[model samples]
Target chain A: MAGFFAFLGDVGRALWGAWTFDTSMAQWFGSHPDALAISATVAVLAGASTLLGNSVVLFLNRVKGWRFALSLLLNGLGFVLLYLTQAVIVIAVGQLATGRTVAWETVVEAVMLATAPLVFGFFELVPYLGPGIAKLLQAWGVAALLVIVQVVYSTSWWQAVWITGIAWGVMQLVSWALAKPLAALGAWFWRLISGKPVLLRPQDVLSGHQFMPVEFDFQLEPGEAGR
Target chain B: MIVSLLALLVVVVLLFLAVGPLEALGWWRAEGADEAVTTLAEIRAAHESVPEPVPYSHYVVYLSGIGAIDGTSIPEEEQPLIEHLRGHLPGFAVLNDVFPYAPDNRGLTAARPMARMWSWIEKARFANPEALVAMLVNARNAIQLFVCADRRYGPTYNIGTAQAILHSLFRAGYQLGSDVPVTLVGWSGGGQIALGASWYLGRAGIPLTVVSLGGMLSDDYGIDELQHLWHFRGSNDGLEKLGGVLFAGRWPGAVGSPWSRGLKEGRISVYELGPMQHNVTRHYFDTKTFAPDGRSYLEVSAEAIEAVLLGTEPKVIPVEK
Candidate 1:
């Protein structure tokens, strides 16, 4: 009952905020006219970007399973790489200075911006290269694949490489975050569907043991030894 | 556990429904609207009283706040104050056009066919102006009466209703004369409108003199070119603190009292009135800063209008206490 009230309180606050938002905003805009349009636009874009990025992580987790850890590592590394890309130094000493200090969000943004073009190009150039390139020369097949993938997707060159690296990173890190939660949910759902007498516990499943273990009958052996 | 969770969710939803929507609606409705409408009707009636009207010395242009329409939503007690300005300000003309000077209300309605038509016209009035006497009265009404009742604060606290008001006045100026002066008397949110108008108009090579009462003018007013600015504060009012924030944030390097901060060197004037509440017209009039003793905001602002337009020192009359 207490938890239910807490949930109700949260909902009420959110709704009230939304409802009052317009009038309160209108009044604010009335005072600070110049900043209204720009601020609203920035806020909207930020929210949309965050939501889209989270969805992509969920989608990739379903496909790669445990390999999602690679996605997480790559995502983290991509951020670090982008941060390093900003400061080009003599003798490449800045590379050593770059560490985990770079935020994951910034890396995600870089990957999103960079990978957007590659995804667009793959669908566009693949069909044209398939038949036309085959007739031109079977020996140049490897070259043709490179041309379609690299030429169209790799337009900006360095930035594209950086972005693709980040995209690769996002895929891996998201897989890592989702892996444990997804597995737990999966077990819960399986127990619900199969009507098994087992508790929906991921730890027990991983350990290969029953949640409620039974005692062994070693008492009879002790009495026989005494006789 | 499942039942508890579900029950908890239901209760949470019910509480939200009970409070959230209602709070939103209450704040939205708190905007003091009828005052503008009442004031407009009174002006219309006052205009009817003139047997043979003279071409106004300047246009008494009033801008409404965010949520309500000016002239149309003014309260009854305040009607005479605006009417006196409409009837008395020498060379003043009353515009029949409802510029939808308020953006939210700038839409098609039975009474307002030209709701936002002023936006286009304001552009045309860049060079011409007979003169403009504007009242930044709407914002005060909305904030002090409407938003204040809800006790909610947000970014909206920073917005000013002056931009739209200025745009309309600029258009009106274009229709009148190129070298005309604009006198503004703004209260609360209307004060912001006045500040923005003066800033924009001053930059355009037109002269603007604004006298604000308990308004929200911050140094942020982009009025480096304004000829003159006057600021007034009711000592006891709560809005002074917030308005100062805008002044500090927007106008980083301004000097002088709050009123004179954006004015040219030696052009700014500051007036500190005795401690009073919002809508203290009587106190303002008795202080001899306003035209008629114990008059409404519209009448008092109009008196200041005559001062700016005629370019003379205001006459002082002792109130018979």
Candidate 2:
């Protein structure tokens, strides 16, 4: 119990320090590998927590047999994808964009450590304030990430933002390109494996709602004009 | 040095914000209308080899919606469509037309902001012109072949799509109810283009039956020119149903037009699938279709076309999932 409180206290302090952009936290992580590991692990856990429970439950239940395995594999793949994207690929992009060299370890460590604010996601269940707080914390985490990257990459504040911003744009482009194909592929795989295709919502048509707010004075459909 | 570099970056971002940097850079512009015409001409030229001695009783063309190539790269939506047609419609020679402009989806943003941005310009329905221009580059005209149907994603591009369809039939030695009756089936935006084909190609003296599967409606002049229009809509395809209602003149009102009037006059047949969707591929093709012989919407549609062409009831009974 005491150890748990100690861990919580340490996490709280680190998160507060990150929110404040305190350089001492960065210095401490640079000197103390164990603290860095522990905190980074916590951050990873926090990140993974978003996906962990549902995936674990689905896997254990053997939903569609191979489907469960695919889901679990995808969960792990998601982590690795984020890590490679942020830690390796985005950092490389940052280097190219900013003309500054940041050690791989620095990016990896800062990324994991910068996830401090995500630990507060538990408060997301709070009514009204919960979702708002969650979003604010996420935004705060982004700011914290920019600060950490600036400090560890040893780039000017603007340069850090630029690198991360450029990386973000790249991510957007990549996601735009791959989203449909990946979705189609995944849908295909699921159908092939489970023998059930993606279902269309009955509500989609039944909504009976027009996309436009104004009722057209003109008739678009055959019988709609009379109505 | 950093200050200048930073200034340059800001300028680039502002430029991007102004003209949809990706569009300005032509990242999404895979092929132009000319390429579509060239591809069609090539395929039409290729059809001369060992042609069927007797003319094909029917010439059927399939054009799929946004983000797909109609030919070999036909996406899941129309893969089953082609398969079913092949098995069922032995009298018809199935042809796929590749329309450029709307290419495959490969960008990072899942939102498909470009499609939305361009949609505003095509429809000329803009609540936020500034935002639309920023995303669509303020250039509303120009259709991407891979994109779904719209008022004018690229109005001229539809002409290319229409040209390819028309030439393919002409080269295949087929005509309207003489050499062979033509049936054009379009899925999603392809449906809109299919209607546009009737409007455009009909003007050029080519007439064909159009089969639309959850297709967006158009307000072009030639919508009334097509002899028969079969529209297969899924009950759950709310987004597509919204298309008719969203457009100003296309929606319900006086002076009944093609999209509105054809249904009233029996020129357009509406087949409302029991549990269908905006996508026949996802709901029917990916999974097995309701038809025992793998006949989903298109196979059933093939029957409908046969009835129109040969004076028989299509008996297109929807198998609700």
Candidate 3:
């Protein structure tokens, strides 16, 4: 009952805010009523789609013998935690010198850029080198990133925003770099742990396709190191 | 091991073929009929003007359903039934003559990418400007355009369907009267056509009522935004049981099932118009029942129109399976 009422209250507030938004409503309804209808319909449909999609997932969970309430509760709380984490990050950073707090975004950007090469280097390692060891190296790489950011101080809000934006852009490029190597590492780890030869290439694994190996030439002799 | 891997690869290929390209092929093969493009200005010049007003609370738009052949027009038999409905609407003007039995020009196929598909399909399907004028001979014939579709079923088509119909209607020079709301009346595949068009029309800024008889509206397209979306199906019609996920004998997803959870959170109303096979007029006209099996399109449409006029939110009525 309380949740229902709270939902109603939030809906009422949102509706009130939308209605009272003086600038666009009059112009939109008067000049382009069809656009207004279309926009409202799109928003409503989008929201409904989200709800329907989630419900389907929940139905699958039920088939797996999980309680529906548990799924709902976990999803609901997960969203709350995500919002809280973002809020804390923003508020804590906001307290820093306005431009200084912007460093967090910078840090994220840098981490994204460096991630790919580091993962690739980790994948190049022999089977004995576990991902845990690689992860430690990644942590070190991120720490080194902070020092790099501190050296090039952001002077203004616009500069910080630009830096953040650039870092984000770099992050995307880094993700592409890391993707193949990470798959290699995963394949190696799976083979080592499962006691089987990893035959599939990283690309095949990602594309959800089967990998077929061709014949390999081998020259075998005892004590080959001497030869 | 080799055979197993080969089999696995084959199955994967088959899955892609069945779920992906084949669906696209259906849309491609079901290309919009090469109908001439008709506009409102043309319909207006030819339309028979109405001198007096009658007491109709809403106007119904009927789109022609799909034809397996490309250049087929609305069958001659279906014409009289359409004419009868218009004739009965008291002061209602029949808009069908303005939109004669023309081919759909919308370029629709299943496999096309989503963003560009709808716009292209609508453009391809809308009637030519010449056709519009010949159809709208007078105001008595100008109540609203009616149309339908064949072969295609499901909620996703709702967007393209809506785009084409609304595009045609507006292009026909018919402005929805502020005093009289628009309603959609469709049969069989026409049901899906009406539902799809109404969905987009509502989105594209038309406030209207949609009542589909034996239409294929899967739960995937959220019908909650409709002023009223009544699905009238017969117990024997075998359409109501369809959930829109089956393609070449496979489920697209759990959510595609109409009975799937959370699929019915909006104003979509479902009623079993039993013992009737896709006939809305014959079933409901004389007796107010949609068919002898006892379904009522008029009653459902009326309730929906009442809600719209009163600006009241419809109460969700859960159908007992």
Best by TM-score: 2
- Winner on lDDT between 1 and 2 is 2
**Per-residue lDDT of model 2, residues B1-321, tens digit only:** 897699668545433322321231132123433344464444334333333453677777777665342244434345766776766666778777444222322221224555554444433423432233333321221133112233212233344456567666766775432424567777766677677556545544344678776766555434676778877776667756866674444666835555676767778777764455554343423354565556564555445544544555555555556
DockQ of each: 0.01, 0.01, 0.01
Full-model lDDT for every candidate: 0.37, 0.53, 0.37
- Model 2 reproduces what portion of true contacts? 0.00
Which candidate would rank higher by TM-score, 2 or 3?
2
Which portions of model 3 show Cα errors greater than 4 Å?
A1-227, B1-57, B65-72, B93-159, B176-179, B220-222, B244-266, B278-321
For residues A1-227, write the lDDT of model 3, one tens digit per residue.
99667544543433322323322232332333243233333234323322222332222112123343443454444333432343334334433534444444433332332222232221212111223334554444344333333333434545444443444345446557866776567556545644554433424322311121112211112322111
Model with the higher TM-score, candidate 1 or 2 = 2
lDDT value, candidate 2, whole model: 0.53
* Residue B14, model 2: Cα distance from true site in angstroms: 15
Show model 1 residue runs off by greater than 4 Å.
A1-227, B1-54, B64-67, B94-101, B104-178, B203-205, B249-261, B279-309, B312-321
lDDT of 1 by residue, B196-293 (tens): 44433343333456656556655433334456656556555566556666344335454443334444465656554434345434433233333345
**Candidate 3 similarity to native, TM-score:** 0.34
Rank candidates by TM-score, best first. 2, 1, 3
Q: For each candidate, how many residue pairs have backbone atoms clashing (under 3 Å)?
A: 52, 39, 56
Each candidate's interface RMSD: 38.2, 21.1, 29.7
- Report the error of model 2 at residue B100, Å: 6.2
Per-residue CA lDDT of candidate 3, range B239-305, in tens?
Answer: 4345243211114355433223323445555656444443323332223445233435444433433
